[model samples]
Target: MQENERLARTFEEKRPRLHAVAHRMLGSSDEAEDAVQEAWIRLHRSDTDSVENLDGWLTTVVGRVCLDILRARSRREEFFEEHADPSAGPRSQEGADPEQAAMLADSVGLALMVVLDTLDPDERLAFVLHDTFAVPFADIASIIGRSPAATRQLASRARRRVHGASPLPDLRRQHKIVDAFLTAARNGEFERLLTLLAPDAAMRADDTAVRIGAAPLTQGARDVASVFSGGAEAARIALVDGSVGAVWQSKVRPIVVFRFTLEDGRITAIDLVAEPERLRELDVVVLDG
Candidate 1:
């Protein structure tokens, strides 16, 4: 078999697996596709015959490519710079793919991603490989330029951080809390709004949202309630990035989106976003009343 043909066939066979690895590492389907494509490009240019473990070789390349991409965007571990909210609803947010959205959120939980953001590049790589994918420390060591023992240590530390980060609440309870919070907000039930919020709950708006008169941030249950309670009259429940949330529409187009994170059946954080670009990417479907 010709070298090119052999390489093409082998890569095609492994594409799905490689894409899965990339998706977990990068947490964005588009970026995962890019990382996988970059690996194929690297394989295409290299000596295919010399590589004995093709899967391992490709995995290493994808990991490196993803690391580079993460560094460029985040500069340092810190939430991978959410250019677009990872939870921007689902591709079929308003459809029957409720399970699909749930899986997406579970696969790339916003709270979990926020924790992962704090990890240094090498640590994130090691953890995702060893803990998430069960890649041996010996194999991951080469990619991160660390000894196997060091890679193991890296993964351990990252795992510890993850354990201590925000715990996700039951999705069903979370959805109900979101519904009640919005309802209270629309009704101007100030005290009721507080009951549904965490004492330290926060609300933040992206730059685009801020540009349109939204505050950049609000902290504390009282403050957030002050901002949210008696507002959101136009908002309707929808799955924002797989989580049941709210979005405001005009003429059948979304003007802004509300994303929430809950813990213990109380609202913990809320995000207000009006970026048209992000809004376009988010899966938005009005829930049946």
Candidate 2:
């Protein structure tokens, strides 16, 4: 009974930080509270005799709980999109408590929350744990079932998407970077390609692109650079969705569009889009090389 009291005190001390971590990852106070409670329950059930860092252990537990919640939320959203009645009109936001919503918006900027929502479950966890909470990459990697390097890349990609989802302030500079990447890739200049990529750069392909033999996902600067080396001969520098990127055209129409997210003059993320519908949505204008 005495030991239980000590454990309770310790957990209470970590509650605020754990809640903050969950709130940042989930963007919902109620969900964050639930995740924290789940962590407490897990803590009670686990044996801590061998645990060296209880705080880190608890934070990892909370992170894993939040990740599971995010993935489940994604699955539910997908189901709703596929089966919900189109004529039902958008679901009412009435259930949310106005005061809580306002508090959340104030504490975590509404814009930031919206951007965080765009990240994948693992990416969100990695970014929040490593960047926001200062958790180590090794710990985050264990939770996300990835190597430390890959976890770092996930966080980097998420960071780029969160901060790069805006109009380029300098279009010419972006164009130059894209052009350099393409040139290096075409010339098989592996060293130059690596120089153009961020240390944790990543690449992803949509379903249609993967069907055409593009990798679904590639992480790390060396791996990503290798995939592009001796490639992209037919790709032309272009303005894809208002950002400098590249496109592969068949005749006069774009068949594949390469969307890039760059930061600090290094490529952070690359997305290959080949879905016909998605391709149509992009405002791609092939530029003169």
Candidate 3:
């Protein structure tokens, strides 16, 4: 009984931080509360005698629970998008309360939440745990099933997207570069593609895109150009998240989004995102041809 009492007291002390982690991850207070309760239940059932770091264990538990919830939510949204009738109007939010959402958004900074919504689940987890909460990458790696180096890369990518690592180039110039690159790729003009890319250019794809056959990482101008050469015939120029980029649509819904980073009139990086959840969060406005 004494041991149990100590455990209970310890859990209550940790509850606030656990709830904060879940709230940032889920962006829903109710869901965050549920996650915290689940963590408590799990802690009660598990043997902690051998656990050297109870705080780390509880944090990992909450992170995993939130990750599962995000994945399930993504799957459900994809299913609804694939099958729901257009005439039914937009899908309802179900349990979402607008007032509560707004309050949470305000507390978390609405802009940050908007950017967080655009990241893939793993990226979001890495960014929130490591960057927001100062959790070690090694601990996060165990939760996400990735090497510490790979986990750091995820957080870095998310940070760039969230904070705009550098000043954005002029919109008109960016559009022209994107347009020329698309034209070159469609015509198999490999030379033109190379001219528009920096010598050390790189391309990366999210897990969803990689699962569908995209290389996880392509480096060097030649290699990156080769990947796009004779491809992107169906891609169209668009403004993705207020920056000039490209979007590939299937029956009016975006299937793939290409986010570019330009420097000195050359493309330095390209990010191919196809995760349905992330795609839905992007503000894509297809330009009129």
Relative to the unseen true structure, what is the Cα RMSD of model 3? 15.8
What is each predicted model's overall lDDT from 0 to 1?
Answer: 0.76, 0.81, 0.83
TM-score of 3: 0.56
Q: Model 1, 45-87: lDDT tens per residue?
A: 8986777899989989998898888777565323433453554
What tens-digit string does per-residue lDDT give for candidate 3 at 185-204?
99999999999999999999
The candidate maximizing lDDT is 3
**After superposition, candidate 3 runs with Cα above 4 Å error:** 94-99, 165-289
Each prediction's TM-score versus the true structure: 0.57, 0.57, 0.56
What lDDT score is found at residue 77 in candidate 3? 77
Candidate 2 residues 1-289, lDDT tens each?
8888888899999999999888888877778899999999998888888999999999999999999999998898788668966433222122143344344336665456556767889999998899888999999999989999999999999999988886434556776788789999999999999999999999999999999998999999999999999999998776565466788876646778899998999999999988876775566645543
Candidate 2: where are CA atoms >4 Å away? 91-95, 167-289
lDDT of 1 at 127: 92
Alpha-carbon deviation at 45 in model 1, angstroms: 0.6
The clash count for each model shown is 7, 0, 0
lDDT of 1 at 272: 88
